[model samples]
Target: MDHPHLPGPAARHAPPEHPEGTAHAATLASFDRGLRREARPDGPGCRVERTGRVVRQTGPRHAWNGILWSGLDATNADAVIADQIRHYDALGLDFEWKAYGHDGPADLPARLLAAGFTAEDEETLMVAEAATLPRRIDLPAGVRLVPVTDAAGVRLVTEVHERAFGTDSAHIGRQLFDRLASAPDDVAAVLAMAGDEPVSAARLELYPGTDFAGLWGGGTVASWRGRGLYRALVAYRAGIAASRGHRYVQVDAADTSRPILLRLGFTPLTTTTPYVHAPATVR
Candidate 1:
């Protein structure tokens, strides 16, 4: 999934504004409140917890665990950070602190670093009005989109993931499988297949009651890049989100996807970096 919380598509919200405009600011504020501060669990065995100024999730080891939102500054940033470290440490869980560009104190990333958290690559937080997106993109010949609904489908997605991103997708597989099993309406996964061989894959996460749905894990193998497979995947999931009543689709996009997303009507609101703290044993 794009985030650790449940995801969705749209609501009847105002049209998007320029990135630096007042309406855009309002959109970001709404996102922070609805998608972050008031986040919900993404799948079975996961729970969202709040501790004063922090909103976080604790889940099974195979699930995403992290601080979704926080209101901290010099006054209590360190103490709260320490508390979180101890909290997850006690559970023997490695966790992430998702720090956004607009997050407080001007030194939160540094604080996370000092506390032994390693920051991964930063991604642009982009959003688009779901109804404004194309519902379909003509696929290249021989490539077809398939909806993922079972363990077999999940395996195909993870297989495409491992090849496209060059990263192990065991965790992603577990999470997707669990979500597919227990919360089918909350997520939609799809694969681009070239005559039975998976080439591209992605998923949409629907957050009911919120105006935003999340687009996650769109990756295509190097050989398949530039064939518009990724764009097709985005359009595919946006169709699902819009049909499901979401007003917007959000994505944590890397460089490769950002340009395409921008061209496809997504506006960058901010950047987010995952600051991860591994369990002592792993550290």
Candidate 2:
């Protein structure tokens, strides 16, 4: 299923005057290295490995299992992809091969499709300097933004996610909870609520040795849309990223959040699509 919170393809406003090429290179490099080194063992059942230029992440036994940061040449792309598929197949795991617009061997997408991988929606890779994001976003009259700490907070976040995206977020919530328990300072999960009811939620992942901090799962319930909650969440997460010394804040924006991110000074670096291979079913 398409993640409903994915930001759109169009930018509502003109992209700001930023060093587009430089920022894009830096963000992508940081992401490749940072994710390889920092985003591993995300929860109890998860693990990450580097094979050649591909970073293979498996388990949590959820939808996030995939191969990332692939930079293979034409000579080896097919073999490498086949190896990955066989490896995951042996484990009975469904996985995705993430393809970026700027990725090499430009025919990689075609190869994946030919190999029976189905493409998900392509999303813009939005990035910006943390210090450049707006900081003073105002919340609606009854809405309040708070950092998630306990199990209840985790539940609220998952609730908002399920309602906003129409998917079961229990796995995501469990991973977040595990991260918070093991490395509290490395991750931040925030929730927005009207009185005592949850309405919006987002997460910030701080990569200690990299220049980027990632924004994930930013979503608001249907009734809460257009109320500035999403922007507020962005600003709030950006503030945390800046304080943590990250120079850039990056998000894979879907159709819904793209415009909001663009207006807040994020540049569209490139587009990324995940080619998924589902586990074969028994007849």
Candidate 3:
């Protein structure tokens, strides 16, 4: 059996940008608002803000995400942040974060470490407002683009991803279909084809809660490489976000494709590194 790593073909992608209030940071701010999607019945659990924590019970099991500032003295900081962690613990979930480096909470890492928490992995946060993005992208020949919203379309996406990312992830197809079937308007998957065959794929998850829509799993087969299909797919996703009132789109990019994202008006806010912690005995 294989252990799960930093979301290889399935992990969510995040990028860091300034506080949403800034003009250059409008996109992230916009998506932040979009994230207030139809809330799940079991979310926004309790928080131990004094301890710097927020936990949601309805999402992934043992999962939580939050931020903190170390400016306060130890007692005050722990009082604030620890209360939040306690809330997450009450929910019986795991806590995690895809934090950026330059964030203001200077002593956040130490706080988390002292609280029995450990850094899972790091990933650079990236952002680009839709207004600042290029609307035009040239698709490589033989690659057909389509907005898929069904099971068959999702299967093709999973297959392309398996080939490109070197992992078997049929679960990815299920997740795509679930999201598409449940919230077609908020999220969309773009498929790039070579004569009816899906050769590349990617997903755009629009977070109306903040000004950030995320780009994830954009994978192209070796045969489909160098055709500009990937960039075209990204543009397609961005178009969807723009249409839905999202102003920014971000991606946690790998070295191979960082150049392409940089060309698309995306600013590298920070570098994100993924660290894995699978048991020595694979589960």
Most accurate candidate by TM-score: 1
Give all TM-scores, in the order shown. 0.93, 0.88, 0.67
For candidate 3, the per-residue lDDT at 160 reads 90
Clashes of each: 12, 9, 44
Local distance difference test, each candidate: 0.86, 0.80, 0.59
- State which candidate, 1 or 3, has the greater lDDT: 1
Report RMSD (Å) for each prediction in the order shown: 6.1, 4.1, 6.8
TM-score of 2: 0.88
Q: Over the stretch 1-283, how does candidate 2's per-residue lDDT look in tens digits? A: 1243322332122222346568657666676677643556555567778776688788755537888678788999888888888888877888888877767676778888777787777787788899988999699998888899989899999999899889888988888888888889889999898999999999998877788888998888999898898889999999999999999999989877787788889888677777889766610
Task: Give the CA lDDT, 0 to 100, for residue 243 in model 2.
Answer: 94
- Could you give candidate 3's per-residue lDDT for residues 1-283 as a string of tens digits? 1112343332334344444336545543433333322222212232323322322223444222343222345446556556645655665554443334432244545655555555554545567777667778787766678878788899899899888878877767766776776667667888887888888889887765555677888888878788788778877888878877776787777666767777877776554432222222331
What residue runs in model 1 are displaced by over 4 Å at the alpha carbon? 1-20
Kindly report which residue stretches of model 2 are placed more than 4 angstroms away from their true locations once superposed.
1-23, 36-39, 281-283
